[model samples]
Target: MTQDSGVGRICQKPVSALLFDMDNTLFDLVGAQIASCQEIVRFLGYKDGEELFSYFLKPVHGFESHENIRQYMEERSIPIDGMYEKACRIYETEKLRHISPYPGVAETLKYLHDRGYPMCIVTDAHSRDATLRLEKIGLLPFFSGMVAYDMVNVKKPAPEPFLAALEMMRAPAGDALLIGDSIRRDIEPCARLGIRTVYARYGDRFAAGHQDSGADFIIDGMDELPEILDKFNKI
Candidate 1:
């Protein structure tokens, strides 16, 4: 009943590369994001949470759809990008103070970091804030590099961003494992890239098949990762 029994080697030395999702994976983006969404919408004169989530998540599925927003803004003769970017800048600078990692994350990352694991972050979050959270929380140096939606103009569930991360690291796709919270976005895309994925079920706001998910491995905590890797050694 061991996880990763049929996949890559597990010894700490055997697995040298780890790629993580930023938003909900390494940290709890939902909580802070919702808070920021509320603040931004209120600033914009909006009062509905659903509408706010939809507005912020517009760049989630893909950026092409953002063109639609851009167009709508242009039709109204408004500076869409500048306005949102400014609002986003404000949201991010303030939000990082509230952002937090899943329980045991700090120690687990420190464990991996101390072991010399080369880690990279792949995210579909906006430009400044996503990275700032990492830096503000002192987790920034743990990563060797990152690929964000603002950088590539695409979102998760799309392989390009993760692929770019792998390429940037000069690491083969098969040599990496993507650990994240979203099945459709994080797990699915990495799987397609032939990157073995670990579905971080712990601290996930959504359930696995229970909270509406389809991840590969549903973990209960960060400490279990070493055990999972140990089993991989046998496989």
Candidate 2:
């Protein structure tokens, strides 16, 4: 169950499975998220839309959870009944409208799928939302399964979601490689479980480099994955 057809070698340990982070890994989630936030800000008629979005969506200190958003709005005395749900609805709609897979993602996934590599999506997103984006990008069919945030009632970096995905795929940690953009969420957890990791540099929304990230390999783009795997397979 190895493939080396003019690509590089497969991993020496035999990579039977791949776990991918959905946002900012397989697709340009940053762009989609920005669009979604813009729609919400517009709907709310914020005069300083960008500043407001940045204040709320800043990478480190910004709010991510619905509860956080609600709390922020409440503290600010923003009077919009059911504003959270409305924002969510608008964001989801706008995100879908702008959703797109990163360059070469579809081809790479198809190649791996054709080579019989089982793939699973492990995301901090809700199942329905993840599924919608995956389906929109045409990458859903290639995945053997998915582990959403709600599934394990925890996010990445906790290892529960990663483990849940592996369990569902019946793939051992050593036999799996996780490709993701976030070191904190994807790489750290997988590495703790003895799963190999490939840091997706291209999808790094935070623009963090490989300085302290313990990734097994670093790839600039998804197109380089097959070759990297081939080289690893031969090692």
Candidate 3:
């Protein structure tokens, strides 16, 4: 499922550094969150996990806020004090328990790392959650630094987080490659910054259908990245 834009050779400047989106790009964070929602609902004797999951999608409370759980409970007239704390704990614990990197992620990362490509993470997650997830999956050591939502106080689709990552890695936009799942947040923003982007199509869960991603390259899996990098280097 790899597709290239076929506009031109990618080596206008050779890629010297890598930037990655930490959530679905590296692992299925949404899937883990869904599973966590299911666990929470089951523990509370609720019938529909999807109903609980819908609360996180609401814009009132941020996606990661535990306040969503409270709101969900209140709507059902469920007790809030002890139950809210317990629900939050179950959600956090189960989410982390279910997280694992996509296949070949570690190998691809090691391949890139061994070849001297400095990497940084740009994520919408808070710093603590990002650190915990990466550490849980044992990929924390691979990144030189991270620009988290808490650090930049901005999320992707904004240029600030991407700029902060490039600065942290000391890599010019043209000389760095960013791999991420969301076209709107990851691809378009990086393209505007003159950074080459690899849209992780395999990780995308939000796009409605098969919309064109507007990325320089698209990879179906992490293992395909080395080949893309090879093309960049050879050109």
* All candidates: CA RMSD (Å): 5.1, 4.9, 1.6
| TM-scores, each model vs. reference | 0.72, 0.84, 0.95
**Candidate 2 lDDT, tens digit per residue, 70-119?**
55456668765877788768766887889898888999999889888889
Model 3, residue 177: displacement in angstroms? 0.6
The local distance difference test score of each candidate is 0.68, 0.77, 0.90
Local error of candidate 3 at 184, Å? Answer: 1.1
TM-score, candidate 2, is 0.84
Backbone Cα, N, C clashes tallied per candidate: 2, 6, 0
Predictions ranked by lDDT, top down? 3, 2, 1
Clashing pairs in 2: 8-230, 9-230, 10-233, 11-232, 11-233, 12-233
Best by TM-score: 3
Q: Which runs of model 2 end up more than 4 angstroms from their true locations?
A: 1-11, 55-64, 67-78, 82-85, 232-235
lDDT of 2 at 81: 85
Error of 2 at 120 (Å): 0.6
- Cα displacement (Å) at residue 170, model 3: 0.8
Measured with C-alpha atoms, the lDDT of residue 29 in candidate 1 is: 69
**Model number with the top lDDT:** 3
lDDT of 1 by residue, 1-235 (tens): 2244234423333555788887667777667756765675566555653454554456553422334334333544655656766555645554576688777777888877877778888888765756678877788878888888889998778889988998888888777777887778887778778787787876567663564334445676776666665544432
